[model samples]
Target: MAKTDKQIAQEVLDAVGGRDNIASIAHCATRLRIMVHDKEKVNQTEVEDIEKVKGAFYNSGQYQIIFGTGTVNKIYDAITGLGVEGKSNEEVKSEGKKQGNAFQRAIRIFGDVFVPIIPVLVATGLFMGLRGVLMNEQILAWMGMTPKDISPNFILFTQVLTDTAFAFLPALVAWSAFKVFGGSPILGIVLGLMLVNPALPNAYAVGNGSAEALKFFGFIPVVGYQGSVLPAFFVGLIGAKFEKALRKRIPDAIDLIVTPFVTLLVMITLGLFAIGPVFHSLETVILTGTKWVLDLPYGIAGLLIGFFQQIIVVTGVHHIFNFMEIQLLEEFKYNEFNPIISAAMTAQGAATVAVGLKTRNKKLKALALPSAFSAFLGITEPAIFGVNLRYFKPFVCGLIGGAVGGFLASLFHLKASGMAITVLPGTLLFIKDIGQLPIYLLVLAVSFAVGFILTWFFGYSDKMAEELKRAK
Candidate 1:
């Protein structure tokens, strides 16, 4: 019989030295963020040796243990149950002093807020890409060849599946922000829903939109907070601080009712008057800056997209780029400059494929093959954490290879006719008016060749050989 999720999580917790060793804990789609008092206390090698564990990394004082799908929450619960004492209230207070300036804090906050939702975004993105294949080819249309050929039911289903995540993104952000700020996530979600509620008048709405629009004391204006990033983030931050303050002042008697009432009143006022406009301005500035940056030298954009793409995937911040892509697609109707993204995706897949082909370790090779295939299918985390990153040389080779490919694509002005990465195999979609297929192919070829050769040449290390021997 398969071990229950809790059982596996408990085993992992015990292997990592129980709850007492952990200083903090969080999770993403496929990894558990374990901050321990002493990193050495967590037997990372032993943790990786576990069947459920995929890989481990020590970065920014966090011991990240990667797992397969559906395992992170289980592992998180078990880790929490281990009676590990989180940093005390005092420790948290002192830690705030160590944080950098506003700009750095903002960047850190953005990373924290965006990284956790990547897996679901990728899964949904892949589904959206595949849906295009089904719909565009007349597969559904053929089934009903009536006057209105396209099946409304199929259209509706696909539309909902593809757009639901984007439409309700604010709520998701609110949940993440709440957790990050150490507030009641459920309450944050409720507040987020209220902000996004379609029935309510959106202050951001230009004309007479709704009479019951969100207002501060029935006067101050507030925008529709759905699909927004900054507003919910600020609200969540204030909400957490308010929760902490209320906890301190309110006595045990009627503390729940009194504290909640006070926090809600303060948070709503602040959200409407202060947090909303500040975040709105910030969002506008970011969007403007991104536009300016992208309009610079094509080579610079290419280099950035190529280098940062893989790094973003490793850190799980690639979804931020995905969000940008969606906004671009919606605004422009087609993404002309996204070939760089395609090249990066191809590079990651190619590197992992190379690892599978070249590695001597049977178990490592086993991990590599499936992960490479997944990367090729546009799911890169498995490949990134499982294969390419494990072999440092291949990862570097892939980055350089991707940059070269991106530069070539830019040089030839190759453009993607659609917003999907699935256009890779169908090179016809990438052919621009300038007859750039040859250059495009050459770039892709070089990227693949470089990745393969680098992996084969540098992969057969002593540790890997030993691992292979042990597996045998």
Candidate 2:
């Protein structure tokens, strides 16, 4: 019998020890993120067995249940209606921080600040990709025109699509960071704008020796923080703190005017003079170190990163990669991390496919196939928690597949034009260069084949399915 939404929600609540035990409830993309008061009262196995529950696992101090996209919202609504209050994602994250250690909390913060900023970047990347296609020499030749024949105004229009986001990227980052840190987001945007004010020397121009930095007090070199992440992030963080501190002391009558004025002035000064210079350098150093590690000889770096990336996901710290990806795009105009991680994602999905093909249990097979499809679209929690992680061996096999795929990625020097999107949708990132699409497809194919083959032969059998069923 098909279970109604209410039934599913109630079962989920019951499975996790009911309304009283849930300290907080939220949903993110594909999972029901719940913080329960007592882990001892929750039944992990039963939760996985619930209708529409793809899988369940404890991560970052929250019991996350996979329900896929679209469906998660319905379930979340049903759960919230049943006499249990629903917390916003940020509020739930706050509750979760009380339980997670330092590293987990930091990763969660990274996700909170950066995830909202990704859509604009993805759209810009797609625009860049499409522009690349339109401007391709071969494509232009087919249209009986040379590159020089294209209108200057049209070229400028393309630049508007491609360059605007990164040009004002600090504003976006600062706005999001301020909101995350509990400050006035508008103030953060204003502060971020000050960092890239036209009066200051452009960062790219300074890098290229076309322009010089302005001398502040004859020694401090002040330049516009164009395409910079850390400066904007710290400015937002400190600005939020400063604003909150001012709010406590300011009188209610003039609080609104006084708080914003003081916050913007102090933050802009610190951002351009103190925080901007220091953190930009730090961001550069970090990016340089990351590139060095990723550029290790003979794809060894790829092998290590690919094999262990999923394990990091299991620990719920993988959002830390957002910083690396963002920095890579800012520094090099290309993201090497995207393709490597895409390969890792592909391998996990392939492993799930193998499980679906091999499992004789109807219920398990039903769960595995759709989860694998979801993984190909670049959501891996379903495949990982529902299928790959169940047998352990398949998970390891997927890691091996990912390592090989990543090794090939490095050897081929695979790079994506953007971040956020991966696997099937990630193909759009490779469309800029003529041969890149084929190579990217080849990498995914190899990852899938290796993952599927290995898991099929050695990672699973009918016996394990029988055992899992008996245990249930």
Candidate 3:
């Protein structure tokens, strides 16, 4: 017999300690994101036992119950029907401000704003990687063709596929930020377009000295904000507030006309002179700071991130890295962090497998093994939430394994030409320098071996499986 979504929803509410514990609620692609007033009141193990639930984890002050994609929407609706109010991602986020320090809350807001937009970036990155593969010297040479041998139409097709998103990325960011900040999304998009308007000097061109910035009012310098995230986001936020404020004052008959017009006029001015350059400078500083860390001695930077990246993933805040990776791919044309991050991820999957093999409990084995396979395929949430995080020692073992792999990757100067994908799918990113394929494989193998061996020897136990047993 198939269980109804309403039944599942009821189970979920009960498992999370009823409506009293829930301060605010929302849903993402695969998880029921809950901000609860009392974490201690929830029965986490029981929640994981639900047939439809894939995994569960606490991250960034939210109790995230994973139900995989597609199924989550039904469950979300079921809960909403049960009379528990569902909040927008931003509204729920506002409720979470009390959970962490200002810095943590800022990071959470960044993740919330950007997570919904990652699929587009991922699609763009995959195409970018594929284009690289098509143009690889080895691939072309093997096909008995030189670079010039490629058809012009095919080249144009690839360019159109890979380049368009990055060219208009600010608009996407602006639209998303507006939605998050409770503004009119379309108007925010218009503001973004205005920043990249053709009349202003193109940002990339101005950077190379091929175009000049125009003078606003013959005093303030104005340049296009193409590829600038902070400016678009900040401007979109202001525009939303401005429009809302205007809506309050204007007469109903003329409100729609006056509000958008005034908001756009004021925002375009502020975006060009006040917000754009300042935030653009901040973006530069942020990227430069990250690059400086990446350049540090003997792969120490890799060591740190490779070990703890999964910890971040567990919190579900890993989407914040999507923006950074996209920025790297667009500006630098390669992703330096991919190899290290992949190593960490592969290690997590490996650790899960080790626990699966070592566990005497049948249910634990069933969950751990499949989660391990998913992790190997470059999806680590199943492994992290369902298996490794459940057994604390396995998570630590994975961390140690990733540090070693990441160190090796950084030491060898290995990098991915793509940004989003990793592991087996990530291999495409190395086709340009196919000789590095073996080294990349070696990184994965080493991570897997270390994680597997350590976990098999010392990771899982009766105590760890105790809760899982109840869930089952």
TM-score of each: 0.61, 0.94, 0.85
Error of 2 at 167 (Å): 1.0
- Order of candidates by TM-score, top first? 2, 3, 1
- Please report the TM-score between candidate 1 and the true structure: 0.61
Badly placed stretches (over 4 Å) of model 2 are 1-14, 27-30, 68-85, 88-90, 466-472
Over the full model, what C-alpha lDDT does candidate 1 score relative to the true structure? 0.63
Question: Residue-wise lDDT of candidate 3 within 349-372, one digit each (tens)?
Answer: 899998888778676677788888
Best by lDDT: 2
Worst 10 residues of 2 by lDDT: 463-472
Error of 1 at 191 (Å): 2.2
The CA lDDT of each predicted structure is: 0.63, 0.90, 0.83
Weakest lDDT window of 10 consecutive positions for candidate 1: 89-98
Query: What lDDT is reached at residue 104 by model 1?
Result: 40
lDDT string, candidate 1, 107-153, tens digits: 55665666676555545555555565555535445665443556789
Q: Model 2 over residues 1-472: C-alpha lDDT tens digits?
A: 8999999999999989989999999999988999999999998788877877777888778888988789999999999999889989877778877676887888888788899999998998888888988899998999998899989999999999988889888999999999999998989888888888899999999999999999999888899999999899989888898899999999999997899988988888888789988999999899999999888999988898889999999988898899899888877878899889999999999999999988887877888999999889998988898888877888998999999999989888888888899999999999988788899999999999999999999988879766865886
Please list all clashing residue pairs in model 1, or write none if there are none: 19-84, 201-213
